[model samples]
Target: MNKMIALMLAASASALLAAAPAYAQDASYKSLTDKATADYKQAKVACDAHSGNAKKVCVEEAKVARAKAESDAVAQYRNTPRELGKARKDVANAEYDMAKAKCGDRTGTDKTTCMNDAKAAKTAALADANTGARAGTNVAQNPPATMKENCDAMDATAKAACMTRNAASSTKVAVEDSVITTKIKADLVKDNDLKALDVHVETVNGVVMLSGFVPSQAQVKKAADLARGVEGVTDVKNGLKVK
Candidate 1:
């Protein structure tokens, strides 16, 4: 009957509509992956211009860029807040790895401090990411309970110092440095003239270190200027090389 044909056409339209979003998501995922791959390749090519510890650092930076891009792609495909938070954590871990690699170029107390600062930055970033994930799920945010447990093994005086140091490090300088680095990175990403992927940003005690590769001396100056403009950035160590 004519009514049966009308029903069939309506069902087909409904099915098509239901499939459209999934197709769009798949396309988006592919696009992100393609861009990530291209960026990784470009970053690796930049690494070819360096040697020794600098070369190692450059390779780690390239890996960090690729990890961030891939994680972002997955997060977009899932379209969930938790996935986005996980993507952030993934990027933090990549940055941590790169930071440790940079520390290999130092020695003694300097290297120790570098490693500690890197760990602190990672912890602050992970904590923020966890809070974001919980907030997205309508859960209350609290400092992880392990923070207290970690100090429990020490004696009274040591424990007090440990707790004080942990509290101060977590809530003050490390957090501020992380915020500055993030803002600078966001700014760089927004600037069309900068190859944001080719630059690695690291902050410690308000000092921002701009590393990795840039194409021109102007961009090197632009990056340092951008970092210096960020709030809480006391100084910029422009290690960015013109390639």
Candidate 2:
């Protein structure tokens, strides 16, 4: 009778063990379903709260969030992981769209500036994600290093020239900064009486080339010195001869 009781107890324990996984799986499915429902509700709320272009963006984000939540539910219900990564990528794309919408209108220089700022922010985020994916490993953020590895890298002089070109392109956008031009004129006219000499200031590549004639050497030097003192002026060429 003790032997039979022991056998019955063993069978009961085995049956409980066999049932545990299915119970846990059902619980997981319920949790995921709850979470998905919550996410869908939140997204709908967000969609209702926005308007205009922002409304469009909000709706897109909401859709992505809902999709991701649903995908998670499916994965949990089916005990599968295949579509989870794709859902994550869709969520990332949604985030990117939201970021772009935050940057506002891109019609002119403002748009270009906004896009550049957004690009920088995206690059930083990508770098952070890459680092996290690597589990605390460090990665270089420089693109030039990758270029050098891929191609026959230019010599130091050529590299310097390339840097100069890139800088020139950046500076070209700021060429419309009127403060620098105003300051250049103010310093040129300050202290020294410019009433007698017709002076004009022309800037090329940050080099101030003075081409007006002044009455005396003192006046010429004064003008050149003033031009040189202006911020952003690289060099002042004293092309003015004493009249």
Candidate 3:
């Protein structure tokens, strides 16, 4: 169950970690953080009744839930790569804390192994967050105009190949993401089943992000399935908030 949770966390973070930068912090986010903190206090109060190791686990679980709620609120409010990276770290930290607490339930070397696994998971999540931060910084540094200038010197055939290169990030996954985004957009334009929906698609490192409002959950599923069916898509992040 813990492993399943970690895999889901990996998937969820990868998609959300791709975002544009925010120029200014907003009051709405402050309000959300306050609410989340209040909720955490209430949850902790409720968890106070449990005893011993159970009490510790309950406290950790409450903290984890609160951390997730707070992170989601931050990401939603800012929708920036930096904020997303922080959110990912916050979630990973919360999960790691819970995992460590759970390790108390184990005995001897088994406990050591569990703690080691938790550390590995935390390290991986932090590394991913760091990569996302670097990717965002690279995009900021390498403007599209510079890439266009570089491609301008190539022959028509060479330029055609070079055009597939991502101006955002130079990773191979970015190349696949570029083609996948274009194909998915084209598919949306021509597919009759998706006619009723207005979806915006973006891809970062082969993870497709579908935003904008959808008519229904069915439409959300349809859009996600369509993107998943695309050849280069590593994963689909359905952000289509239903109406």
Candidate 4:
């Protein structure tokens, strides 16, 4: 029937509309991956212009940077917490490669120390990233019951005072959060290392949240580092996806 055909056409249109964003996202990430690949090739070629230890170091750095970029691109394409965690791990791995290569330039106890420090740094950064990933995976956990227990011990007048103070504390936290967010964003706009990042900055209870894409692993760390340097920021949680 004519009506049935019209309905079918409408359904097909609706399906296509629903799929548009996903398609666009896929296309965008494909472009990112292609550009990263081209850039990696150029960098690797530049490394060949050097010789000996310098060329070795350059080659290692190029490979590491490329790996990090690919991992980040894949994570952005997937846009999942698990993938993001993997990207962070890839960055740590790349850093380790650079560290090992740099250590190659040294000798004796200095080399040993450099290797040890590199391993420690890699371990710490990967552990931190995995900790966040685990937290994201299991959001439902035992919440402390201490708050209710303490409230039960309070008399009526004390309970009223506690409520008033808690309300005031929450308001103070909000004000501080807003101020810190503004300051951090302003500072980010100023710093050359961070200015081009255009990262999303948010704050809650003095903790800062950074989410967006940065050009490299260094910028990822700089995002959180810059936010933490702000006067009122209590902590920084980096959700910035690396390019």
Error of 2 at 92 (Å): 3.6
Give the local distance difference test score of model 3.
0.69
lDDT of 4 by residue, 1-243 (tens): 999999999999999999999999899888887887888789989988999888887877776667666755654465454765676677677767766777787899988987887787677658755865675421112112232234456899998887676555555554665688779979999998888654656554566767544568888888888888999777887866443
Tell how far residue 96 is off in model 3, in angstroms.
1.0
Candidate 1 lDDT tens digits, 53-101: 8988888887788877776476447535577578767877877788888
Superior by lDDT: candidate 1 or candidate 2: 1
Query: Relative to the unseen true structure, what is the C-alpha lDDT of residue 148 in candidate 3, on a scale of 0 to 100?
Result: 45
Q: Against the correct fold, how does model 1 do in TM-score?
A: 0.56
Each prediction's whole-model lDDT (CA): 0.73, 0.55, 0.69, 0.69
Each model's TM-score? 0.56, 0.34, 0.50, 0.62
* Candidate 1 wrong stretches, greater than 4 Å: 71-77, 137-243
Local accuracy of candidate 3 as per-residue lDDT tens digits, 45-72: 8878998888887787777767766765
**TM-score of candidate 4 versus the correct structure, residues matched by position:** 0.62
- The local distance difference test score of model 4 is 0.69
